[model samples]
Target chain A: MTDIIVGILAFLGTIFVFLAAVGMVRMPDTYLRISVTTKAATLGIGLLLIAGAIYSNELAITAKILAIILFLLLTAPVSAHLIGRTSYFSGVKLWKNSVMDDMEGKYDTSSEELRSGFETDPEKSKPTKSSG
Target chain B: MVDRIIALDLIITTGIGFISAYSILYDQPALLDVAMILALIAFLGTVAFTYYIQQKNKQ
Candidate 1:
């Protein structure tokens, strides 16, 4: 029974990781690649770790596996965010077919700051300020 | 722009994860430590690469 469960988990984990790899290649832009790969890879890693823990059937190994899973879960998002931010700052262009860019013109490259969409238009804010 | 859409570190990390699981199934627990360290280094490597890219573009 344990073997069956472990095999199932390992298979599922492999499938997810494989999907991440495929997405990485198929995605058109850097941001899209990062977004797809990070979530899938992280989940795959967690599943693989869980399977390993079950297969080992040792308390110490299981604890270590859990720790690894926890660490990966915490850092995956942070690293992905860092990569995407850096790519944007480095002027990686978006997909040509991308419809709307929420961050367009909202990022102040000079100061390395990101402003809200509403805050980006001084003209829009000026009318409200004058009315108030 | 990088030639590849995805970063190399992500692929390496996934491979290490798979290897670690295989190691456990094969009755070699020691390899798990190595896999964990490799994964850690892969993540740090990605962060460092991004920082480098950011600094390069800052100019």
Candidate 2:
């Protein structure tokens, strides 16, 4: 029974990881590709890791598997964010076919004061007309 | 940048593929676990990085 279960999980995991690769290549944009691949890989690997843990029946190994799962969940988004933000700053062009400009609209017309979040709080930043 | 990242992915995947192949051949569950996890991590990290670069490019 355990062997069957392990085989099923391993097979499922392989399919998922393979899908991630396909998505990475097939998607037109970076974010979309990343989303597909990252999400798939996480679930796939997590399952496979757990399968391995179950097979090993070792508490330590299972814990490590769980740790890796948790770690992946936490860092995946952050790294993707970094890459996207950096690409934008360094001037990677947006997909011409993209319909919206959610990130750009904010920066396009934004003045320095607006950008700094002090547009309505000049008094708070002033040395005070009474003092300076 | 994609080139650099792809190069890295290829290298890591090659290394990991070797390790995974070894585990499968030798029937080492522990080694298999390690390979599977590392491969997953690399796959995710690269995909994520690619997204970020794209997002940044958009910005």
Candidate 3:
């Protein structure tokens, strides 16, 4: 029974990993590709780790597997965020068909800073400057 | 973009780690140490790469 279960988990994990690879290749742009692969590949490996723990059924091995999973879950999203931020700042163009871009006009390329998009009232600005 | 690439690299590393761990399970249990080391390397590699990219962008 354990063998069968392990085999099933391993198979599913391989399939998800394969799909992630395909998504990486097929996605239109860097951001889309990153989004797809990050989620899929992480899940794939997580499943594989679970399978490994079950197969071994030993305390040490299971503990190690859990640690790996924890590390992965913590780091994957952070790395993805940093990568996306870097790419955006570095001027990677969005897909032509992208529906919305909140960052548009808000990012200052020269300073590499994101600007607030909210409209500032001229009266408030004048009053603040005069008071100061 | 760099993040995605980093993630892809990590995913590949993880797959390799899985393979190594399976070998340890079936073949030489002594190779368990190899799997552990690989996990450490993968974690450190991601951190180092992210730092490199950030530093490069700052300049």
What would the per-residue lDDT of candidate 2 be over residues A1-132, giving only the tens digit for each residue?
Answer: 887887787678767777777777777775565467557766666666666666667787667657756765676566556655555445456656878645452232212121332456665343221100
Candidate 3 local distance difference test against the native: 0.68
Which pairs in model 2 have colliding backbones?
A: A83-B52, A83-B53, A84-B52, A84-B53, A84-B56, A87-B56, A87-B57, A88-B56, A88-B57, A92-B57
- The alpha-carbon lDDT assigned to residue B17 of candidate 2 equals 37
Docking quality level of the chain pair in candidate 3: acceptable
Q: Report how large a share of the reference interface contacts model 3 reproduces.
A: 0.20
lDDT of 2 by residue, B1-59 (tens): 75346445534444443453344445575775666577577757676777776555454
**Candidate lDDT values, in order:** 0.76, 0.58, 0.68
Candidate 3 per-residue C-alpha lDDT over B1-59 given as tens digits, one digit per residue, 9 for 90 to 100: 46456555646555654674475358444455565566567656666776777678678
If both were scored by DockQ, which would come out higher, candidate 1 or candidate 3?
1
After superposing candidate 3, which stretches have Cα over 4 Å from the reference? A119-132, B1-4, B7-11, B17-21, B24-36
lDDT of 2 at A85: 53
Using TM-score as the measure, which candidate wins? 1
**Local accuracy of candidate 1 as per-residue lDDT tens digits, A28-130:** 8888888888888888888888888888999998888887888888888888888877777666788888887666765666656656556556753322111
Query: What's the TM-score of candidate 2 when only chain A is evaluated?
Result: 0.75
Taking the candidates one at a time, how many backbone clashes does each contain? Answer: 0, 10, 1
lDDT of 3 by residue, A35-68 (tens): 8777887788777778887888889878877876
| Clash pairs, model 1 backbone | none
TM-scores of the candidates are 0.86, 0.64, 0.80
Computed on C-alpha atoms, the DockQ of candidate 1 is: 0.60
